[model samples]
Target: MSPVSETHLAHRLNLRLNVEPSEIGGIRHTVIQHIGSWECAAIADDVILVVSELLANVHEHAEGVCELEIEHQDEGLVVKVSDTFMTPPTLGHRHGSAETGRGLLLVDALTDHWETTITGTGKVITCTFGTPGRGISP
Candidate 1:
């Protein structure tokens, strides 16, 4: 028998999380469990942080539920976190010794490709991280 190809193995998982103020930890653990199943390398670890930041942002500012969608492509995993916040995310040093304000910056540092798109109702932050041995630098 032959091993399954990476392309055949990477699976896509999508999640919608409420922007509750206190569920960030639970959300992060859920994402880790879901994505960690994949044989992808450090990509899972990188994604865990990204999801935490994204969800934290949503809980802090967004007014409605936050949606998190993850698609595992042949080359890597694509994560999209959408919220109904009107203000755009600015990547810079956090205001001060604040515990927050640095989520987006962290995402930028971890992911290979990332972008933000504004929609009629809100905004969607998308990031992609490459898998370990599949020719990516996760």
Candidate 2:
């Protein structure tokens, strides 16, 4: 099935998929392609990591399908991942030796700003990354 939907115009892509570990790679590639086409390739690595972390969280914590919305703005790119779980994710405090619980930490380190908003059905985690000299904190 086509995970991408043409709901938004240029510079925006919306994907709704069943959250699964096997699908994460395909989703990451889709985001990378869109980032390249949007002329935001400079931040592609960070974006890919952020998307992977977010999708992993959904697959592990949430139930069923999730919606991934990516939009490229003048400053940078915005990624919003909405899942059917109402519980908001916390910034995990994993020890250096721990193997799990570093997803949110990676997101926090990569994104300029990120937040979770609760909807009637679920929660949406929005991550923003800004380009150089675009008001992103150092």
Candidate 3:
């Protein structure tokens, strides 16, 4: 018997979350479970942090509801959070006065690549993290 290859299969979880503050922890937990099911626990911790930040941003800044989609693809995990917000997230210059403005920065630092997609009804923010946790730094 041989061990399964890391990227042998694809797994996806699509979630529609009501942009409420209380359910964030639940969502995070579910995401962790899904990652575990896909046998990609190596990146589980990092994925949870990324999901938490993404959902928090949606609840705080975006309008209406949100959709979370996680997929295991091509030796990486694609985390996409969609919401009804027009403004794209930016990595602005944070001065001493800025109290809390580093969510995307953290996401970007922990993932292989990330980007934003604007749709007709809303926007989607997608972050891609390579398999087995590719060079992640806190």
Candidate 4:
């Protein structure tokens, strides 16, 4: 997928919000709206799905306040969820009739690249989804 174009991405990015389990739905809606407004509906579902999955991990495995930030950079839209969990999250596999353990898997597929980093206070999961932003890859 092409990037959204540097000009448009710069205009739509730099967003940061505090999020929790209770707030995921609303935040998801708002982010999707932003994506749609930018005429990036093609990747809207993928963006929301990845964000939800990341936040769900935060809710299940971490604690304290988590910050969700969406930014447009280089050739992709970057979504990050940071929380107070020093331990890095691990992707798991559960076969047959499993309801969980699929969030990270979904995230892995939707984003071109993703990784978790250890922050001073906790950890942050950052995933990059290729967007319509037309820019040099970074």
Query: In terms of TM-score, which candidate is strongest?
Result: 2
Instruction: Please give the clash total of every predicted structure, in order.
Output: 0, 0, 0, 7
TM-score for each of the candidates: 0.79, 0.91, 0.83, 0.78
What TM-score should be assigned to candidate 1? 0.79
Off by over 4 Å in 1: 1-10, 95-99, 133-138
CA lDDT scores, all candidates in order: 0.73, 0.84, 0.77, 0.70
Q: 48, model 4: CA deviation in Å? A: 0.3
lDDT of 2 by residue, 44-63 (tens): 99999998888887878886
| Residue pairs with backbone overlap in model 4 | 3-132, 3-133, 3-134, 4-132, 4-133, 5-133, 5-134
How much does each candidate deviate from the true structure in C-alpha RMSD? 7.4, 2.2, 7.8, 6.5
Q: What is the C-alpha lDDT profile of model 4 across 16-45, one tens digit per residue?
A: 444457777876777776776666676789
Please list the residue runs of candidate 4 whose C-alpha ends up more than 4 Å from where it truly belongs after superposition: 1-20, 132-138
lDDT of 3 by residue, 88-107 (tens): 99976677677899888888
C-alpha RMSD in Å of predicted model 4 compared with the true structure: 6.5
Ranking by lDDT: 2, 3, 1, 4
